[model samples]
Target: MSCYNHSNPSSFLLMGIPRLEATHFWIAFPFCAMYIVALLGNFTLLFVIMTEPKLHHHTSLDLLIYYFLCMLAGIDLVLTTSTMPKILRIFWFHSHEIVFKCCVVQMFFIRSLSAMESGVLLAMAFDLYVSICKPLRYTTILTNAIIAKIGLAVFMWGIGLMTPLTCTVSRLLFCGPRVISHSYCEHMAVVKLACGDITLNYVYGIMAANFVVGSDSIFIAISYILILRAVLSLSSRDEGLKSFSTCGSHVCVILVFYTPVLFSSYMQHWGQNIPTRIHILLADLYLLVPPMLNPIIYSMKTKQIRGQVLRPFYQKTEVRINFY
Candidate 1:
């Protein structure tokens, strides 16, 4: 049962989707397609934001919104890339072996990026709150320097919080049965395989989740509540609806991102009878669904992004007609 070797501590195997060997290849098709969509969609959104001069010419408040949107797109890219490749390989090629160091790296990026995304969403909520509640002071409140500081703070908060958890997991001695039950390397999944005491690991994991995800969710809720009140107080009903419409895309993205995550976390803790396959499926959706849908949601709901995305095609048609 001695799995650890002092000479090579980085060896481990990933056991992906147990008891589905016959359907692995068939299952991989959809997963691969989703991964491709996530990558292309996020990258396309990033490109549009970075390239569109109109998007950058906005006031400080608008710029902050664009910045957070760009940050969210980047986070979605990293988050999905961290886990999907490994998961796809497991299903498509039966390559379940992942080194311990690699596993640690994947877990770090996935968890850190996720926390950062949550932070970014919270920041977006605040941005919307300012825009809707105090439009006049929006530029004054969120200056360029302040926006930069907020971005830095979000990055630091995620990295700082996840570092201890990663280090703690790395220090544990994993013994025997190096096979991870899930498709990717997750903190809890990896730690559960270790032979050493994991009380601190579990405690720190819970605390990190509460501090990062929990706090972000709470603040987002508060921001929306105040936003709702502000909208309600507006003189015109149409104006109120118009103001609330601005957050529709963000609300959709948040639900897509958090619902599966919260459910998976709950099931892990309380639903002991749930099948491992169900857990794995939820984990995959938690990572994959948001990235795939965020760009589509924003493009459809946000007029500016939609126009920018379509402007090039329209211009091409105009050029053809003028030439003809």
Candidate 2:
């Protein structure tokens, strides 16, 4: 039997997100609080949505919305757990030496969630399209069976798309000067340290983005445009306005979710001179802010959630005000 020693990077120093005074106590403290709130908020939303039968059966879109929200929450957890702790560590101890296996895992976790999120958004878009475009047959077209199938298809797509990415990065032989410029084990950041040919990996990454995220955006845009036209041609202003309002939260959530991702991915590919701080800020916003805002958005937009779920809390506050 022949023994082989696998080549690996010597060491990598993460240029942790920008600093005010390098102590980072102020930055890391707020970020940690945000992570904790994000975790609790998302978990609460998922639990409430799943448990409330009235909320669950409100419309054909309800189930899909719940599923999408849950997926986003899960992504939020993965991102915060993967990146925030590292940032916290740097702030507290100034330790940025990420092991080879941990680096790979971090890269995989980030990419997997980022890519799969596109698919989940696509699923929601499809649900909205079918509900509006094919109103009469919405139930028949998007039966539980069909929803399950679609969920399965998206899952398969996400897994298949991300596998090659993880595999490709894992195969790279790491050596000296393994310092990644970014705070986290971002795909491009880690790949840049490879002492091997990374041209193929870069090409594959671009292709992956185009195939999964690019196509999903195109489809979502088309669906919304059709929905807009359909809404515009309706006779009653109240009916049209109500329908538009229902989807407004979703549209806002989508914009907030995708814009940073598009910006970060674009800069990573095309803009080389962007400030490192901007990159870190955009990535953090892409991962953190959306999850925190999602439940808030939906709660405000959804009458049942606002009235039935949030009303009781508000009423108590109103009572306190009256008492005072």
Candidate 3:
């Protein structure tokens, strides 16, 4: 079936999901709820971290680490909102047409931010490892200058890695099928619809994803292992538990973010026996679940952040009591 190439098509149709068109209206409800929760939780967490006086101090190493945490929140915000609105649009309103330029932008953000999150988590894990495994050197090692450098390096690396993908996809002539099967413009999904050879896209995409996720996971695992060893060597069990708590929230965040990613990746590639709907759902969950759970996990596990969250309420209560 030879068709003329439309180098500049007006738009592409995004099919919400396969074999579940009728249920899309009902499916929109839970997704909307999760999106609302993610917005509130992540925004509130970002606000508290930014406004809290202690976190603003220039001389504080803790300030840099907390600022880095703010990066995680920002990443979560972008990651969730990047695709969810279009997804909700598809499900609720049957608004499945994404502008061609918009689709390219969406693909860039989704892919770049996913890689950035893995790097951010690894950076945080390394910070935790230093804080726990070498308490005395934590301050000396991860200084404000060093932290700033590390953050810069991660962003440069992530963005640099993903920038080529946009070029590769953009240059492809999309004269073939215009209907994308996924709710959002996933990279491979969009690429598949294009005419001509896309072997580079496939190869680069796989290699880049594996490099970011695989390398980061390895480092994160090593960090946690050393952290565990350090915790065990502590003189007291209470001290060990206390030390472990520092990385607990981070550990939870890593698991939530990475597990679904790996599982979904596998299901889409090798798990041929799995249902398409199931794979799609898992992939969607990979983006949604972590953002929703991250703030909750940190709030519950990290006392400082929890206090930052509750301070305003406590102050209001104090004022009311004093007046009464």
Best model per TM-score: 1
TM-score of 2: 0.90
The residue pairs found clashing in candidate 2 are 8-174, 9-174, 9-175
Lowest lDDT sum, 10 consecutive residues, model 1, at 1-10
Instruction: Report the number of backbone clashes for model 1.
Output: 1
Q: Summarize candidate 3's per-residue lDDT along 11-41 as a digit string, tens digits.
A: 9999988889999999889988988888889
Leading candidate by lDDT: 1
TM-scores, all models, native as reference: 0.94, 0.90, 0.92
lDDT of 3: 0.84
Candidate 2 residue 125 C-alpha distance from true site, Å: 1.2
Q: Which stretches of candidate 2 lie over 4 Å from their true place?
A: 1-5, 18-23, 318-324
| lDDT (tens digit, per residue) of candidate 2 on 1-324 | 211126765457787776443656667777777778777777777777777778876676676677767776776777678878887787677887988778777777777777777777888887887777688988888887887787777777777787788788877877757777777888888888888899989999888877776898999999899899988988999978977886798798888778888888878888779877778767765667777777778777867666666767899999999999
